[model samples]
Target: MNILTEILLQAERTPNAAAIVQFGRGSGCSFDEEILCSYRTLVEQAQGLCTRILRRVAADAQVGVVMGNSAEWVLADLALMLAGCTQVPVPLAFSAPQAGWLLQNCAVVLTDASGAMRLQEWLETGLDLPRNTMHVVFGHYQQQSAAAPTSRAALSGPDRIVKVVHTSGTTFRPKGVRIRRDGLDALVSALWQRASKDDYRRYLSLVPFSLLIEQVTAIYLPLTSGGALLLPPADMLPLGSPGVIAADRLEIIRAARASALTLTPALVEALAAQAIRLAGRADALHALFGRPTAPLLAAGGAPVANQTLTTLDQLGIPVYQGYGLSENSSVATWNHRGANRIGTVGQPLPHVEVRVADDGELCLRSTSLFAGYSNDDPSSCIVDDDGWLHTGDLATRDSEGFVTITGRKKTLIITANGRNVSPEWLESAYRSVPGVLHVIVYGDDRQFLGGIFVVADRSRADEIRLAIADYARRHLSEIEHIHTPLLIEHSPDVMAQLFTVTGRPRRDAIAPFLSLQKDPSVHEHP
Candidate 1:
């Protein structure tokens, strides 16, 4: 909670320690990596930017930030919190139109030089924008980092809207999760102490920092423990931005010598496969991570198959599965180092209370709960009168408190014959084929399942189709099999936009493709 305050305190405790590292910066350190900012430098630079920000933005003004991963990006985030501006981050993964839609309400934007060019390009295209928006480029004052502290801007009030996390839901229009200072403070504290289990020393940040979960695990947790934040060089920062093709992500992670990192089910599954393949070699773990020692890997953002976990367990890789959403700020339940279960996301964080509804929807209430969605009526919000945010996710709680997310309460693919299926597992099974990058299965109220596969190599279409058939036959019940499987090829960015941070497909965004399921002429993929 109070990320900026807590980080500043850590800076006071360890002034000269490396706080952030940017790989391939080529600042004459390690040929490609540099301790881009020390704790003191990070604080001072942020404080300097804070002074610049308040001159243009009033207290609690929603300010949008658009940038790739860098020390500058983190600095801008801290500066906004320090300045009491309601920070809204626009993920670079979004197209110009989507980014503009998210930033429509904000009058001021903070950006890096690269971000400035991006915003300017978007503006030139005449995106419907807030009138007369102001832009302040941060990371320009890198020269002043070593200077003594200046007049400090005030911290945001505990009850004030300190940040707004913009999430693109089913609609092209995004929803902003309004976060209060106190709520953030509670979430971060509990997460660092309990969920992280303090095993993280170097957090390899792969996802966008714009993501709330990444903000917690990548920024706050590391800063709380006085650990370093490892950032990928832009070429390697591949998750959110579809434009960026990930270049040997495992190698980048290995090179970082990362101690702790979070992975989507897709990434972890691939990692587990790689680890299992190299198990016979002495450098097997080295090939997967960096050293012979395995890192603390957290798999979330989707339901990882039990097979993936089983493989990692056999390979001696330490993985803790967990679940959360932007509504809970980030993580509400996590399996700590000692208390991990194979199939379940661990118990709720100490601050969170969990309950399963009569219909099996998992609900939770916590101090970390979002204040409400920005500009939305409190009464119309997801959290009901009892303070429970009914997470839409269907789940079951074991006697021991472990929680298993079964499927979406609203997304059960009901067949004409009356059988029900959760498409997550079915999608996971299909996505396991090497060429299939992503899969989304849909057939609600229909007789069979239909799927869209994002393939890595379109030339291998026939081979991948055979592989898909092989996997579907083996892993799926007959009803769970994808009856109409469509193989399509697109840039990774186009494909990335189809899913949420947690790996669930944004159904509305993919509605056009799903419409094919209704066509009577389309038969099963042979």
Candidate 2:
């Protein structure tokens, strides 16, 4: 299937409807939902850009994309798919070393104005690609071309790698996950089957486009569902270093009136908190989402607390929890509107097959399974001979097919926005502090990183906290900054309770000690 062409066909059918809207960027009201592009504009711009790109980049050639969430980001995403180039998306949250690691594998890199500057800075480190390799693509949408646009590029086959999805997870070094067109198509199609056209009248994208899942939900899902994707305000990108949650997210939701959207568990909690404050209001749903009825909300990335899901449901927010991975091409199991099971990651999606292994590990077989890793070791491979991807997490399937993820077999903490965090890498940074003895970096399902530290010297606890703060500000990436830490004198009982016999931190044991209801941003750390 030609995904780009199909989307353009949708635009032609719904020519009068909104294809994309930028809130507060319009001319009229504060949240006027400035028509960034109508379906006609999308066909004109995307097709025109596709024609332009096909002439320069060869089909299946690795091309890198670096930018924040914006209209141009949308164009680059769609146009590259139309041109049949293998897109390599780079997150803005990535450090220079991480970005350089990815760029080394790409022949060409695309960037907006801000990304261009960062790419140029890499030259000083002698780690970036050549000057000509970087293409600044910030304002391509401003000049809509009237020239004849190519409808679609010649896609060779289903097995051909159409995209190289990158993940900065589990390892400090970056790695690419190969995605085939067939898998991508099948995954989206299966999800589209579960959605109605009107579900996402406006789907506000809250996460970075670098996330493959976001690209699927924010771009493809909206296209297939006949929904308009409401891009977040350019400066209001959440999951930025220092602050995982956008500073004014509640305010943005109050204004956008987005009909449906995906959120991390943390953001769900934040919205639930706000919804409680505005409880019983006549226009609460209207203020949060443009509709008076309950808006379709899907939560994933990390495990969403059942209590949190129940809270949103009581307030008319139908929060459907799901489980997914970049390997499975966004969503493997999802709880849709009609069928939802609390405390579980929902039933397996229509396209995916799930089974619990003899060892209780959740294994998945799907057309959407990632092709392969670009550089990681063969020994670290998750896929077995018969095609089932052995996910490191342990799980169980109920009689009704609801799968609950019990625990992980590996030491990886996936953040709420779906970013994978290697606590070991984080702990290494904390342990660098002289007074810091044992450092436990824990933020699974939690948006911002927080820590529990054991101090070498009891009197130096305050001093160690200050030093750790300095290290976080000067050394660590913004997103990796620990929100707060519990520095205490070491005790055998405390250590025993924090980690299981296998040495993994006991999340439940540590939960009561951590602060909730507030996660201070990077600025608030010091």
Candidate 3:
């Protein structure tokens, strides 16, 4: 079942209902200045765009999208799906060379005016593009005399590849994940089944459209449920800074009256800090959101600290964290409203089976499993003979079925005494310390664990170090305690090298930068 069918159905049944709302460029808090598209108009425009794209590309040919999250990007994605063309989405944050590398495998690339200009600049810098690759700017999509195809069945089968999402692999390089129509349909079904029955009137899109999680929850989930997708202006929520993103996101959620939101852990942490500042004033918090409260906030992409979750709960905004990967078509386990466990990423969704292997790896079998990697066969990379996708995450499932992720399989630290440790638990615990911004643990072959901490202020380094030392003494065993805490300078370059796009610490990428710290101290304070 093609997902576009749902959009068409909504158009036929409820033509006047809002399908998409594009917020205008302003202070990021203006709902009066907006462009609203009805269901009928959305379908007509998508069909019109589909008519133009079919003339340029063959069936099942790859179509690349090098644009940010906006109404134009949404239309292009739907047009490709309806036209039976596989979409290759490129995030705006990717470098010109990285964008070109993704475009090399595609038959056509679609972008807005700015994206086309960026590509032209890259070409002038001697970046090569495949000779057969076609470039189609969004505004130039002319309505041809030929009739547009309404359904995808005429061009491609449901089980065939429909989209290729590019994500960071274990090697820290970009890799393409292929997803099919049936897999996407299964994912939508699982999500709808897992979520509460309350109808979400407006859903906010916070992350980049290139991300698979955003593509599903932000776009597909809302579409299937007949909810309006509220997209902020391109300049309002830039991905450059976490602080800016959190501020803009809060403003838009209030202005748009969004009933649902999916966010990254970094964004959640930033918002938690803001919520703490607004704690005592109920009226001010109500005025900030415009309503008395906001909607359900679902977080993912990284481990959300217990402090962050508790702070959000105190603000009257519930947060449910989930665990998923690009290989599983976005979500495998989620803590929905019904069965939300505080610390664990909730039970497996419908039709998804999860188990822990003997070696502490999480294996998943789901109907929504990705087809395969773009350059490698499924069997070679993750999928095993029994059809389980071996997620490289170390996790444990409780008797009640909640899954707690410990760390990555490739990031386990082994001491000389042969004790293995996962740093994520310790990092999360350290985050509970006030003023602690980031922590990375390292002790591969050493006698004791040591770490680098990025704090809010250099003067408070001693305070944070002593707090962590006391925390380790109370909670951790002797073998797991981190004896040395090294304070480091926080800079943009340091963050870029140490963190992934979703704000998860990349242990291997951060290992080389750890040498910048000159001294490590064991706190004498209790």
What's the C-alpha lDDT at position 30 in model 1? 32
After superposing candidate 1 on the true structure, give the runs of residues whose Cα lies further than 4 Å from its correct spot: 25-31, 130-139, 142-156, 195-198, 243-247, 375-381, 411-526
C-alpha lDDT score of every prediction, in listed order? 0.71, 0.73, 0.70
Query: TM-score per candidate, in order?
Result: 0.75, 0.87, 0.75
- Top model by TM-score, which number? 2
In model 1, the Cα lDDT at residue 506 comes to 79
- Compose the digit string of candidate 2's lDDT tens values, residues 1-526: 4566567678768877788888764454355557777777775666666666666666667788887777777887777776678888877666667776676767677778666766766566555564445454533543234543334334334467878877655555666888878888889888877777677678888877888888888888787656799976666655534554543576667667777788876677777887788789998887766568766788887887778788778888878888888788878888887788789888888879999999999999998999888878322438999999998889999998999999888767777656677777678777888788777887776666668887867788667778988876555556777756767678887678676667666766766655432433211231
Q: What is the lDDT of residue 81 in candidate 2?
A: 73
Show how many residue pairs clash in every candidate, following the order shown: 5, 4, 0
What is the descending lDDT order? 2, 1, 3
lDDT of 3 by residue, 389-508 (tens): 998889999998999988876665644222335676567767777777888877654435677787778788778778887775444434445656777667787788888878798777
* The candidate that achieves the highest lDDT relative to the unseen native structure: 2
RMSD to the native, candidate 1?
10.7
